[model samples]
Target: MKKIVILFILFYSAVFAQSKFPVDSSYTVKSVYDKVKKAHPYISYVPARNYKTVKEEKEIVYKKIKDRELHLDAYFNQTKKRNPAIVIVHGGGWRSGNKSQMETFAIEMASKEYSCFNIEFRLSLEAPYPAGIFDVKNAIQYIKKNARKFNVDTTKIAVLGCSSGAQMASLIGTTNGKIAFEEPNSDKKFSSKVNAIVNIDGTLAFKHPESIEGTVAGLWLGGSYAEVPQIWEQAAPLNQTDKNTPPILFINSSVPRFHAGRDDMIAILNKYGIYNEVHTIENSPHSFWFLNPWFDETIVYTTQFLDKIFK
Candidate 1:
């Protein structure tokens, strides 16, 4: 009888421990995270959306290029009713990476009562810079065109991205009202303006002609700094800063060389008294926050920021 009681107590303790996070485990992509399943519940919690319709579908929004597949995942819950929407962009230096990295994030947002779209754009090597940005613009128009089907509020659309994805997100968010990014063939005139933006370790200085040299900027932009200085200069988000720009949340590591111009972007944002927050991980490695303790921290801070802005 004593042995049975002892085993019961042990089982309960193990179950409780699993509910909490494992700070000791190193961060890994979602696929490898299954190994530490016993110690982490956050992993399972992210991809379970409460929406009525949750599925994957592919569409061809751009026609200039063939074989370009635009993959999207969506979630919506009727009980929750109409909610804000957020489009997510994953980072792989513009050359690689896919929409799956944000599957858990999309689910989490849906659980929070926001319809979410995890989208994929063209890669630099495949089509290049303006191409990806153009892809984003088309995706927004497509969403707004099908807003009724997705149950999105349309007016409360927001965007979030990390690393290279951050750069693309910033560009789309900042250039919302601009005419230069408009798709010539599409009749969908819904404003591209995003209500809020969350950029993690993204560059804001793509507009600087001199800075465009010798980086992925060249490949994505389809030319080196020398070849198309003007395109690089105007393509960056810093050039589009203004008072009406949406609220922004910036999260980054404390690395100096990589994040050199983020402070200036923050300063520009302050001029408008528009809400902005920067959370820097002291001495943390670049993209370090994407792992464990920091990963959870990112979600908490990001969700809090979203709550404040969206509410």
Candidate 2:
């Protein structure tokens, strides 16, 4: 009896620990800052400042799936006219990180007359691939359903993602109209399609010549390149690119590996005559969007691209 009880205890403990492989708190703006501060000492945390003209609302529940409740922060200017909306997705290798990292972008974009949402989704630590994808896509449906209240211009919706989030954003944006990626619970009246995408320092392909992805990425993606070649290709924006893909803005850092398959994706986009843009921040480190100078610089490019497409 004693031996059986001990075995059960061990099994329960192992299961509990496995369920939280990557603790969300383990990754934060401060943590990322600490890791890169030594290499780029000049970089500093981007302070959050409301435009004052824009209203900020946090923790708005967007979706409830089983035990998981997803939420987002909304920043919008009180206006009589409908405004463009941008759904912002944060990055932590898809394992850790939260919507709060995008608070600054939401606030600033709101001040610029854009209804911006900093959205949260289950990370790989909780629910692996496609689950997070569906969460974000469904959040878009929720945003569209409440478009009138938020003064959103449904025709002008966009998505902006950083690192792994960017990879997902590209996947979601390009896969628009594909029934294969649709979630049954998503709003039937509205689809999870966007007019534009902004990818920040994210890979276009996990299996490309310039890709450095290995164990760290493979963990979230289910397996290594060799173990799951088809899955890797399936997730790549390069593979999903079609003539229907929306206009994209690539705000890349100096790292080349992160830009893997980007040029190829661009080639396809150009073939279809779809609008696309790329701007690499010289000497900037990965995740530079969290730092000053670059943070503001990113907003500039973002708003500019948005205006070109939606304004």
The model with the greatest TM-score is 2
**Reference-based TM-score of each model:** 0.77, 0.91
lDDT of prediction 1: 0.70
- Write the residue-wise lDDT of candidate 2 on 13-47 in tens digits: 99777554446576688987898788888888887
How does residue 267 of candidate 1 score in lDDT? 87
For candidate 1, the 10 contiguous residues with the lowest summed lDDT are 19-28
lDDT of 1 by residue, 65-166 (tens): 444356666655444355778888887677766776777677656666677787777777667668788877777777777888777888888888887788
Instruction: Compare the candidates by lDDT and give the number of the best one.
Output: 2
